[model samples]
Target: METMRAQELHSFYGKSPVIQGVSFDLEPGEFLALLGRNGVGKTTLLKSLMGLTDGCTGGLVFGESNLLSLSTSQRAKLGIAYIPQGREIIPGFTVRENILMGTFARVDGRREIPEYLFEMFPILREFIGRKGGDLSGGQQQQLAIARALAMDPKILILDEPTEGIQPNIVKQIEEAIIRLNRERGLGIILVEQNVPFARRACDRFMVLDKGRVVVSGHSKDLTDSVVEKHLTF
Candidate 1:
């Protein structure tokens, strides 16, 4: 796993800056949660990491490579898997085909889906032939995660992964994320609304308000007052 460092990063969409001077570090095998109210540039920050933004400036280094210099596909090949909000799996593709798409970014040229993905998400195995559009929201989220895992990433970036999903499936997804970090030792940066889960699962927390980071510390320091001040809408 490689460390991702963003120094004074700024991202713009058609000259309007959404992420302003945001800086942070995601250490190897670390789980960092991005907590903020809606439209605080959390999603935009994630997009910037993947080079999906209209423009970005300042330093973004993943391992030894300068991420700002790399294309979106190049970033993926470098082991940063981004699962954006809305879980954008191809609607026409079958579960099997959708997952195989991720392998196209693999540097090793392996096209086969890893068996452990099935072990993590058995629902995908059961609905292997089903189109991505046919799956329920929760199942589609699982498929999105499974597809990302297929790329064999060193770091996983997720944007509100459990938002709008069923409660039961939310637990499953949360557990899977924890396992990916704790058991598999994959680094993670999760944008989340569920404060309790974020506090419980993440090693560190960063709170964004407007476009800048207002609070950040170890998970243990994420007190009720901090949430009430910055997170409570």
Candidate 2:
């Protein structure tokens, strides 16, 4: 695992700036939660890291590579897997195919789905032959996560993964995320709205108000006052 650093990062969609001068460091195997209200550029910051923005400037370094110079595919090959909001699994593809699709970005060029993925997401294993569109929303979210894990990434980035999920599945997903970070040692950057979960699961938390970090510290320092002031909408 390698450290990811962003210094004075700014991201734009066409000519409009959505993420303005944000900076942070994600140490190897560290879980960082991004907390904020809607449309505050949390997603944009994640996209910027993956080079999905139309344009960006500043320093983004993952390990020894300068991420700004890499294309989205290149970044994935570098072991950064992103599970965007809405659980964008290929609806037309079978669950197996969708998970295999992630292997295309693997540097090893091997397309085998790791057995551990099945162990982590048993539901996916049970529905391996089913079409992605047939599964419920929570199942699709699990599929999305399994697909990302198939890449064998060193860092996992997720956007509001538990949103709209069933309460039971949400607990499962949260436990899986914690296991991925603590047991598998996968560094994580999670954009989430659930304050209690964020406070409990993350090593550090960053509160983004308007495309910039307003408050940040160890998870232990995430006080009620901070949540009431910046997170309560």
Q: Candidates' lDDT values, in order?
A: 0.95, 0.94
Candidate maximizing lDDT: 1
Candidate 1 residue 160 C-alpha distance from true site, Å: 0.6
- Candidate 1: segments with Cα more than 4 A from true spot: none
Please, what are the lDDT tens digits per residue for candidate 2 over residues 1-233? Answer: 68999999999999999898899999999999999988899999999999999999999999999999999999999999999999889999999999999998888889998998888889988999999999999999999999999898999999999999999899999999999999999999999999999988999999997899999999998999999999887
Give the per-residue lDDT digits (tens) of candidate 1, residues 1-233.
Answer: 57899999999999999999999999999999999999899999999999999999999999999999999999999999999889999999999999999998889999999999999999999999999999999999999999999999999999999989999999999999999999999999999999999999999999998999999999998999999999887
Colliding pairs, model 2: none
lDDT of candidate 2 at residue 92, scale 0 to 100: 94
Give candidate 2 regions above 4 Å deviation: none
Instruction: List TM-scores for all candidates, in order.
Output: 0.98, 0.98
